[model samples]
Target: MLLRLLLLICAPLCEPTELFLKPSPSQTIEGNSMTLTCEIQPRLQTSKAQLQFCFFKDNGALKSGWNSSPELRILAMWTKDSGSYWCEAKTAKATTTIRSRRLWIQVQRVPVSDVSLETQPPGGHVTEGKKLVLVCSVAKGTGNITFLWYKGAMGLKLGTKTKHALTAEFEILTARENDTEQYYCAANNGFGLSLSGLVSITVRIPVSRPVLTLRTTGAQAVVGDMVELHCEAQRGSPPVLYQFYLKDVTLGSSWASSTGGASFNLSLTAERSGNYSCEASNGLEAQHSEAVPLIITVPTENRRDLLTSGVIEGLLGILGPTTFVLLFCYCLKRKIGRRSARESLRSTSSPLPQDSTYLNSPTPVPLQPVYGNVNTLSGDDIYSLVYSTQLEQESPAEPPRTLSKDKVSLPIYSKLKKITVIDMDYDDAV
Candidate 1:
C-alpha cells in the first residue's frame, strides 16, 4: 500500500508538461517593487527537479537566475516598466528548456499636482434660492482618483466621486445664507494626496417685500404737514436702500444697515393723492410693496372763508324752484296785457286779425301797438278776446249776444303759491 501511494504522488512528476510565472503583486504603485517566481505546474513535493530560471521583460531584458534561485525581483518600477514579464525553466534532466506563461504587471502613477475648485456662478458669491455647483478638478495627474468636497472648518463631507476623469462636481439645491463658508476639495490616488486652496462661498439674500405705514395723528393728510413714510422689510441682508412712491413718482429714499429696514418723509399736499407704494432693495433687484389708495381733500375752517359744500348745495336747492315760478308768472302777465290791448282796438274801429296763425305767432309785438292804447285797455277786455267769434258760419246754435257786465268778467289765474323758504331745523329738535 505504501508503494502504491508513492507511485500516485511521484507519477505526476515523472513527466514534465508546462511551467508558469506568478508575481507576488500584479499591480504596484510608482517607485515600488515586485517579485516573479517560476514554478512547474505538475510537481511533487519531494521530487528533485533541478532547473535554471531566466526572467524576461516584454520578451527582452533577460535576467539569469541560478538553479539555486528561481525568483527575480524588479525594484523602482516606472511607467516604462509596465509590460508582460515571464520566465524560462531548463531542467538538468531535460534536453531543451521550456518557457513559462507570461504574467503582466501594472505600474500606477500617483498625483503630484494641486486640485482647484470653481463655482458655477463664476464668483463664489451666489444669490439666495439659486443652485450652487462646485466643480473640483486636478491640474495634473494620471490614475484613478477619488475626489472629496468639504464644507467649512467642520470638514463636513458634502459629496464624493471616484473615477478615471480628472474632474468631479458637487451641487447644493437652493442655497441659503448659512451655506456661506470656506470650501475645499481633495484628490487622493493610491500613491499620494493633493488638497486645493480654500474657496469661499458668499450667499447674498435679497430684500423682502416692504411694508409701508403712514405716520400721522389724523386720518387725512393736510397741506404743509410733514408726513413720514415708514418702510420695513421682515427679512433681508443689508445695507438696504428704500424708496417711497406716490402714484409711481419717487418722493425720496432712505437706507438701513445690517438686517434692518428704512424710511422716508414727505410734506403732504393736495396733489399727493391716488396710489402710494414703497420699494426695498439690497443692491439686487427692487421689490415693491403693495399699493395703498389715498384721497386727499382741502381743509377749510369757517363758513365765510368758503361755505361748506353741504350748506351751499342746500341754498341752491331752495332758490332754484322759487326763481323758476316767478319767471313763469311774469310771462303770463305780459301775455294777458297784450291780448287786452288787441281786443280794445278791434271793438272801437279796427277789426281783429282774421288769420288764426297771426294770433298764435311768437313774433314780437309791432312797434305801433306799443303806443296805441295798450296801457289804456281794462282787464275785462282780455277775457272776451279768447271766446269772441262772430257767427259768420255758425252751426244751428244760440245767436251771439251783446257784451254785458256778467259775461265779460275777468278770469283770474291762481298764482303759483309764492314759495317761501323757512330756516327750520329738519334734524331732531334735541
Candidate 2:
C-alpha cells in the first residue's frame, strides 16, 4: 500500500513535452521532394531520459517511432499529398504524451489553354462606321483566367478581362480604318500563358459618291477615238467593281482589287454619243455618279464623202440643160430636112420654077397649132407628118400646074456650133 501511494505521487511529477511539424516549403511543385520536420518543444539534452516522435496526416498516423532525431523526410509529392499534418511527442518512461497544432500545405497546378478569337455577324467583314464584336475563348483550361486582346504584330492592346469562365467578348463600338487588320488574343493563368492564332478581319466601306471621269487624247471628243470611262471613290475598300453606262445602257464593266478605282475602255462611235454615267460597288451598296454629257463631234476626214457627192450633183445639173438643147437642135434639123425634100420634089415636077417672091408672101392656108399646145405645133407633130401619107399627097406632082410667083417656096438656113436651124414658109391655097 505504501508503493502504490508513492507511484501515484511520482506520476504527477513528470512534465509532458510539446510536439510540432515543420514543412520545408508551405507549397511545392508536383513530382518534387519535400521535407517535413518533427520537433519537440524545450528540446531535451539530458542523458537520463528517452523520447520518441510520431507524425500524423488528416487525423491518421503517417510515420511512428522515430528515435533520437525527430524528423520525417518525403521523397516526392503529388496531388494526394496535400493535407493537414501534425506530430506527437512522448517520453519513453510512460510518463507523458503530447500533440501539436495542424499545419496546412497547398499544391499549385493548371494554366490557360486553347485561346482563340472570332467576330460577330459571322461575315468576317463589316462596313465602316459600324459596330464590331470580338469574341475570344478557350477550349480547355482551369483556374482564374486573364484574357488580353491585341491588334496586328506589335500592335496596340485593345482591352483585357479577368474572369473564371471559359469565354469572354469585347465590342468595338464603331469600327474605324485601323480596325481593318489581323487580330489575336492571349489567355493567362498564374501557372502559364498561351497565345491564340491570328484572325483576319475585313472592314467593308460603303463606296463613297463615285466620280465619273472621261479620259481621251483629243481636244474634242469624236467618233472612232479611243475613250476611257473611269470611276473612282474618295475612300473605299478594294476589289471594287465599276460599271459604265451610256444613255442608261451598260457599255462595259471593270474591276479593281488593289485600288479604289476602275475603268472601262471603249471605241467611240457617232451612235454612242449620249449622256454617260458610272457606278462603283465593292460587294456592299452600289454608288452611282451623276450623268455627264459625251457629245461626239464630226471628224474632218469623214467630210470627204459628202464633198464628193456635192460635186457629182452639180455635174448632173449642168448635163441636164445640155441634153435639152441638143434635143431642140435635132428637131430643128429634121424640120429643115423635110422642107428641103419637099422643095426638091417641087423643082423636079415643075420644068421652070416660078420666081421665089412667093416664099416671102403670106400663105394661102392659115396654119393653126395642134397637139399638146393649141398655140403652136410641137416638134413631134412635124416629125409625124413627115412619116404619114398626108405629107405624100400634099407634096404630089399634080397639085399646082400654074407657076404663080406668089405660090413659090422659101427656105432659110443657119449653122450653129454643133447643129443647123431652118425655116420653111408655105401659103394656103386660095
- TM-score for model 2? 0.46
After superposition, which runs of candidate 2 have C-alpha atoms over 4 Å from their true positions?
1-109, 299-430
Per-model TM-score versus the true fold = 0.48, 0.46
RMSD of 1: 17.8
Give per-residue lDDT, candidate 2, residue 76. Answer: 70
lDDT values, one for every candidate:
0.70, 0.70
CA RMSD per model (angstroms): 17.8, 17.6
Report the lDDT tens digits of candidate 1 across residue range 226-345.
777888888777788888888888888988886557667777776687788999988877899999876665676632434666677888899889989999999999889777656655
Highest-scoring model, TM-score: 1
Off by over 4 Å in 1: 1-84, 87-108, 217-220, 295-297, 301-430
How far off is residue 415 in model 1, in Å?
59
Clashes of 2: 5
